[model samples]
Target: MADDYLVRIGKLIRDARQHRGWTQTQLAEALATSQSAVNRIERGNQNISLEMIARIGEALDSEIVSLGYSGPMHLRVVGGRRLSGSIDVKTSKNACVALLCASLLNKGRTVLRRVARIEEVYRLLEVLNSIGVRTRWINDGMDLEIAPPAHLDMEAIDADAARRTRSIIMFLGPLLHRLRQFKLPYAGGCDLGTRTIEPHMIALRRFGLDITATEGLYHAQVDRSIAPDRPIVLTERGDTVTENALLAAARHDGVTVIRNASSNYMVQDLCFFLEALGVRVDGIGTTTLTVHGVPAIDVDVDYSPSEDPVEAMSLLAAAVVTESELTIRRVPIEFL
Candidate 1:
């Protein structure tokens, strides 16, 4: 446990140094130590004293260590303690998934700011890693950095990790742009009844993908010649479905129109991300989106997804149920 903390703190120091555009030698000078000593500290090869940790935090202007307060998970006194202060909503899991899949579209490095440290994100990272994409959590684990492999090792995919979330469906759109043939396990996650994936198939087929589901797997084949010459109308306005279409359209090299689309928070965040990738998207907040696809995307982009509306709603529901006064910040009122 002590070693783990030391490694995490070391990562925090390295991230802070990079953020400030400082070299190891520069940081070593600031710390009045040799570059080799600083390197050892950053690599977690040397144990650091608390005084040195505090000095490093001060030098980097970061709170590398945190003391979290634990609270009861269950109600024992009928919510006797009234909540009064405001709390900010964290980043969205949906956006994080969308952005992770979208990162495959870029050949350069992708940096995401303040991404949420959720199980879903961790699973997605596992899948990405299994397929040869290099990823790391840095900047006190608030940021994520990803670099795509020259060629993906599809056979090495982490099937267990990929099956943990239904967000795996979003991979269809982006992967279509990268591979001509690939197989994915049946989409899994929270069992919210028998929700059909027919809509996803319908949207992706417009971009020349043919998917066949049989015996717990989806065998996907792509026809490189297929492109949407006209507007593609989605059968459903589901957020992941819309994001799938957007991911496909992003690298299509022509204008693709999507109707009956989702204007949800995650989809909007995806649109902004597509724009950052140099794809033009119109109607970001509405049900119709016109995406002018580019032939290629190779930019080292940095993007920050919006706050979670569902989280805000959860806080509001807790406050109302407990009859306690609380404030939720960054609610993304448009979602309401």
Candidate 2:
């Protein structure tokens, strides 16, 4: 038990260091410790003290351990004691997934800078790598590089891996281009009410993707020859659905007009990224979008997704809870 604890902490430390783009020598300098000590800690070769852990976390700019957040469940407590410290929000769950889906378009390696190390992204990566995508944890698990494979190993897909995340739905955009026929376990994420896959279906229909839900799995069949004939109209102001439509449109060979599209932050990010990949998207930051897909995309694009607003709000809430006056930079107040 003690060894596992150190290993977890060591992993956290190593992850934080890699996330920060720091070398062991740099981390050692920050912590005022020897590089050998940092190496041993990352290797889980030595026992560390709580004071040392806190110092290491401070140097790494990560909490590493926090109250109210545990594995498996998001625990919320109504009645709580007062505090005097402050905290910053992490990142948005929505934007992270959108970016993950967007990574599938590039032929060159896609490196997501400072990705949220949440359970949600973890599940998507698991599913992505399982299907022959070369996903590497380059920097202490913070930097993610996703590379496309010549042929996907669809049978190796982790049903249990993807079923835990709603982000699995985003695979529709990437997988449609990779496989004509495939099956994925039903998506499960937050209980934020009924999030229908109907929007995804409506969006991808223009690209000839027909997905059917049967026995806790999504059976999808794609006929790539069928392209959009007319403008695709969305049913809701849904963000993910709009993104799915945008992604599908980005890869199609002709121009696709999408109506009632979400002008949400995530969709905007995805649009900007698509443009980076040489897909011309008009009416961005608006309800209507026109996408001109590339017949073949081979550009090595590098993009940094914007900061999340919800995370900024959570950080503010932390300041409120602790009754501390704190300054949270890049709060993304525009979204609020």
Each candidate structure's count of clashing pairs: 0, 0
lDDT of 2 by residue, 155-248 (tens): 8888767766777788888678767999876665222124577767777877988877654567889998898898998988788888988888
**Model 1 agreement with the true structure over 234-297: per-residue lDDT tens digits:** 9888998899999999999899999999998899999999899999999999999999999888
lDDT score, candidate 1, position 34: 95
How good is model 1 by TM-score? 0.71
Q: Against the unseen true structure, what C-alpha lDDT does each candidate score?
A: 0.85, 0.78
- Candidate 2 — which residues are off by over 4 angstroms? 1-89, 189-195, 314-325, 333-336
Candidate 2 residue pairs that clash? none
Q: Estimate each model's TM-score.
A: 0.71, 0.68
Worst 10 residues of 2 by lDDT: 186-195
RMSD of each: 15.4, 14.9
